[model samples]
Target: MVPASSEATPRKRTTYTDEFKRTTVARLHSGEQSATDLAIELGIRRNMLYKWSDKIEKQAPDKELRAPGRPATDELSEIEKLRRELAKTQEELAILKKFDAYLTRLKK
Candidate 1:
């Protein structure tokens, strides 16, 4: 049995301000540094930067979502959305290439 005195204390959660988030997202979009480099500089996880960027980009031009409290219509995360898009694009490209090959064969 572990003694109560030996239990580890919980770590504090870190929070960033909206201004800081905007600046970070801007820097990310500027192409001056990679996400890894920026994250390392700011002492945050690389994926955290992506999360911030996604949320910021989806906000209204006035800097707020239409319904802040409502759940997202699409449940997928930003990364998953991009992943699905990439997969669909690749599938279309492959089909086109195959169709082109068939057309070339018929022309022969």
Candidate 2:
């Protein structure tokens, strides 16, 4: 068997407690410092700060953490997820077709 390479192993995601996340998000919202600066100081990605804030906004007090795209449910059913994707793809296709028609008119 080939030896496992350290580089090939994925790093585990760092998990933060709700209280820590809550305080960090609150500090960000307080406007004492810019989000980029705060992220640098805290050694976290700026986008993660925004994500935590969004989650907090959607959560009821003392509620379990609710993931994005999952509200009041363990997870969205696969069919529902697929339906959403199909709808989005249909909208994109419609727009592209309209754009193509517009360009064809321009070429005439």
Candidate 3:
């Protein structure tokens, strides 16, 4: 009888890119095919595909609002106004603290 070890072929490790993983996860989410079927067709394990799908879902929120251009003029103005207000508030607080310290020194 032939040895069982000799009859078995070695399996190679494969690496997939982010684009491929995203595409595969998208297909899996479409509900067209079972994960087992897709994994088998793609020559990868079902568990690996599941992991990829989970990762994609977890990162979906972060990927949703990717603005590819400059901020709006109104947003820029609002930010600048808030920054100026914060600086003015900080300066006023500093002045008040200095006055309080001077008053305390006078009382001493």
Candidate 4:
């Protein structure tokens, strides 16, 4: 029979909040220590800290709604309204052209 696995099983993944990220990065930027020291103190990976810092620097201040399972808001109503207005303008141009043709025929 095969021996039981010698390697340790993988650990479950964990998540951190935005607040935690901001606080940890702030501590790193305070100039009192390096990322390696901070990572050890915080029980997290140094690379994770670096990734968070990069994200914070490139982030913009905006609130965007994200939904993975639903369709986005519909713009079809506004598009249909503009299309109707365009058709009305085309009809008016056609009437004006017919009147011009009638006037020219009368003058011939």
| Top-scoring candidate (TM-score) | 1
Model 2 quality (TM-score): 0.49
Better of 1 and 4 by TM-score: 1
Report, for every candidate in turn, its global Cα lDDT versus the true structure.
Answer: 0.81, 0.78, 0.78, 0.74
Off by over 4 Å in 4: 60-108
Quantify how close model 3 is to the true structure by its C-alpha RMSD in Å. 10.1
* Per-residue error (Å), model 3, residue 36: 1.0
Model 1 regions more than 4 Å off: 1-6, 60-108
Clashes of each: 0, 0, 0, 0
Deviation from native of the Cα of residue 105 in model 3, angstroms: 68
Report the lDDT tens digits of candidate 1 across residue range 11-108.
89999999998888888877799999999999999999989977876773543432334344454477688899999999999999999999999999
Give a tens-digit lDDT track for model 3, residues 1-108: 998878978777788899999888878767798889999999888999878866765556553322224344466799999999999999999999999999999999
User: Which residue pairs show collisions in model 1?
Assistant: none
Better lDDT candidate (1, 3): 1
User: Model 2, residue 55: displacement in angstroms?
Assistant: 0.5
Better of 2 and 4 by TM-score: 4
User: What tens digits encode model 4's per-residue C-alpha lDDT throughout 1-108?
Assistant: 655787668998889999998888777767577899999998999999888876775462321221123222344467777899999999999999999999999999
lDDT of 2 by residue, 28-107 (tens): 77778888999999898999998997788667443344333434432346668889999999999999999999999999
- Tell me the lDDT of model 2 at 18: 96
User: What TM-score, over all chains together, does every model reach?
Assistant: 0.51, 0.49, 0.47, 0.50
